[model samples]
Target: MAFELSPLDRELSNKTINENGFSVYVSGKIKIDRSIKDIRHPRCKGKLHSSNLTTASVIISFFEEHWETLLRTVASVLNRAPSGLIKEIILVDDGSSRKYLKDELDNHLATAYPSGIVRVIHLEQRGGLIRAKTAGAREATGEVLIFLDSHCEAGINWLPPLLDPIAANYKTVVCPFIDIIDANTFEYRAQDEGARGAFDWELYYKRLPRLPEDRYHPDEPFDSPVMAGGLFAISAKWFWELGGYDPGLVIWGGEQYELSFKIWMCGGRMIDAPCSRIDHIYRKNSTNFPKAEFGDFVGRNYK
Candidate 1:
């Protein structure tokens, strides 16, 4: 259900876009615990997961993220995932200058979840996304470490399929089939087609046709040479064994390819769990992010 905005509201939303690179006004209007479509394969509806899937610590790193969308992401995860399987939700603040993200965020989470499933880590300096995630992983206590962008909404039954594979083989890494969440109207929908993760010669992220065998078992996980990087689950032990993200890769660039290739070459595998769907908001415009001082960090990381 979409909200009808008044003329004044529309004007405000446009202004909000300039500030956050998305319609924060529209995101604020939507219920924090709003329901989204399941958007999974037909066979996924009745698929059974292991009764004893390992617990996970979901780590989301954000800097200057919109308040409403951030809250909604946590809400969707809490509402959809089984309480026992979620050891904690860690929000790593990458030195956000925004006042509201400071005390207000801490107070809200404390009041809303008295059981303390959510924790926030405030970095003294802006360590970029790569460092922020590594910081969050260092404090995680769960068997699995799940990384998600600050603006994603977990679809129905999104957790089990991801954790099940890791439970079977600790070396396996699983990523959800990411859907698209509209940046403007905040509409939730599926991506046009399903493709496996791949990369070209220049190390640019690319997608290839799903294997022919994938059609036979549409609900099962399939091999992906690389992960989209924004959302995925990995065993905490395996993640640390692989040394997490390279400390040298400042900000966001080629960490996806780095981690993906490392996983394959180091005798581990990456898969896209078909039954697990997570909706991500692809921004209509670039946010007012600070430029990284590190020169050619992308090229350096790829090298």
Candidate 2:
């Protein structure tokens, strides 16, 4: 759904866009538990999952994320997912400078979710996304570890599809069909049918047209050459076996390719679950954020 802003809201939205690279004003107007239309294929509606699926610990890493968007990401998971399947939700704060993110966020989670299902880990020093996620995984106790961006909304019945395949084959790594949330208007919409994850010679992330056989089975999980990096689920056991992200790789650049190659070479496989849909906020002005100086890290990691 898209929101219509007033003249004053537009001015505020523009300010947020300049600051956060997205419309924080519009995101603030959205309900924490806002309902998004189910855009999955018809076949996905009747699919059945194992009754004894393994539990998952969701880890979200943030630096200076917008308040409402982060809260909505939490709310969407709590509201839409089955409670029994979620072991915990861990918020990894990668040295955020925002005052509200410190004590205010902790207090809100404590009061809002008195069950203590949600918790926060504030890094005293800035650990890049790779290390932040690794820290979260080390602290996670669930059988599976699911990594998500700080500003994403979980789609209806998203967990079961992702878990079902992994439950059957613990060596499998699963990625969801990522939909786009408009950076300016806050409109929720589908990206497309689907495509295979791939990369060109330069090692930049790219998508290949789905094979003819994959097009014939739109609702089933299909093999993907690489992951888009932000959203994916891996068995806790398999993740550790693969040694998580390379400790030497700083910040985020070629980690997706690194993991994708590890999955294929180490007697494991990566699959894209069509039934699992996740909406991600693609920011407009990413250059506004201060860049961490990790010179030649992408080239070094890719090597």
Candidate 3:
């Protein structure tokens, strides 16, 4: 089901689309000042357990992203995740032209980080998503490295479950189930069942089906083979050894497949942890990006 927008929502949406070429502009204007109490899945609660010793550094990268939604992302992590498990939060700005994301964000965050646990790094050149994320990953000092979209909200107790897999084997890359948050109304929604990421020969990503027989227990992890590029957690050591993301890639699209293949080739496993969750604002763009940049993804030479 889609979110119903009110008049205020419509106004904000129109303003946002004009700026970002999508609905995230509306998310920027949204005030998530108070905690989002009900956007959680029923399964997220009820006796959740996670590894306390497995600490992590959450990295978020963005270019011209919304402000309010970004802080909500950090706030959700702070409010729900165990303090000891979160070593730090790193925000990387890929040459954002926006004024607020710079000093305004730094100043705003200055009061927030007394111990210097959270930081904002600015790049002079616009290094697309892949490079920008790599910049954040380079600064990570935790055992597990988590990469989250700048416009996402953390689900209750999400970090521990993602780290649980890596603690078993450093070669595991674990991702939480993603919930949907409306771009216009900011309404949160969850899927009835769980699915994993897959891709076609055309290089297009799709949601694979889930089977009940695959589960030995209600909260067990499933093999995704691949995961959405926007969100996932991997061992810091393995991520660096596997070469983080392909530096040859520019912007977005093909990087997910590139990283997925590298993980499989190197004897690493990718899992979808349903017990952990996060809400993402699925970006929608009516027109395709410039062909010069993204055309290679669909070309016959993709093999």
Q: If scored against the real structure, what TM-score would every candidate get?
A: 0.96, 0.96, 0.88
Clashes of each: 0, 0, 1
lDDT of 1 by residue, 1-303 (tens): 455778988888888887787888899889999987778888999998898899999999999998989999999988998669999999999999999999999999999999999989999988788999999999999999999999989999789999999989999999998888887778899894468988878877888889898878888888998888889999999998998998888878888888988999999999999888899989888784556576666677777
* Rank list by lDDT: 2, 1, 3
lDDT of 2 by residue, 1-303 (tens): 798888988888898897788898898888988989989999998988899899999999999888999999999887888779999999999988889999999999999999988999999977688999999999999999999999899888999988998899999999999999999888889999889998988888888889999899999899998999999999999999999998988877789988988999999989999999999989887733435575666677777
List candidate 3 segments past 4 Å from native: 1-9, 21-30, 37-44, 47-52, 286-303
Say which candidate scores most in lDDT: 2
Q: For model 3, how does the per-residue alpha-carbon lDDT over 1-303 read when each residue is reduced to its tens digit?
A: 344678887776777665554576455556655455554445556645644458899999988777777888888877888778989999999888889989999998889767787899999977677888999999899999999988788877787788887988899999888887776667767754578788887777889787667554557788887787789999999999998887777766678888999999899999888878788876655322434645554242244
**How many residue-pair clashes does candidate 1 contain?**
0
Q: Which ten residues in a row have the lowest lDDT in candidate 3?
A: 285-294
For model 1, where is the 10-residue window of minimal lDDT? 288-297
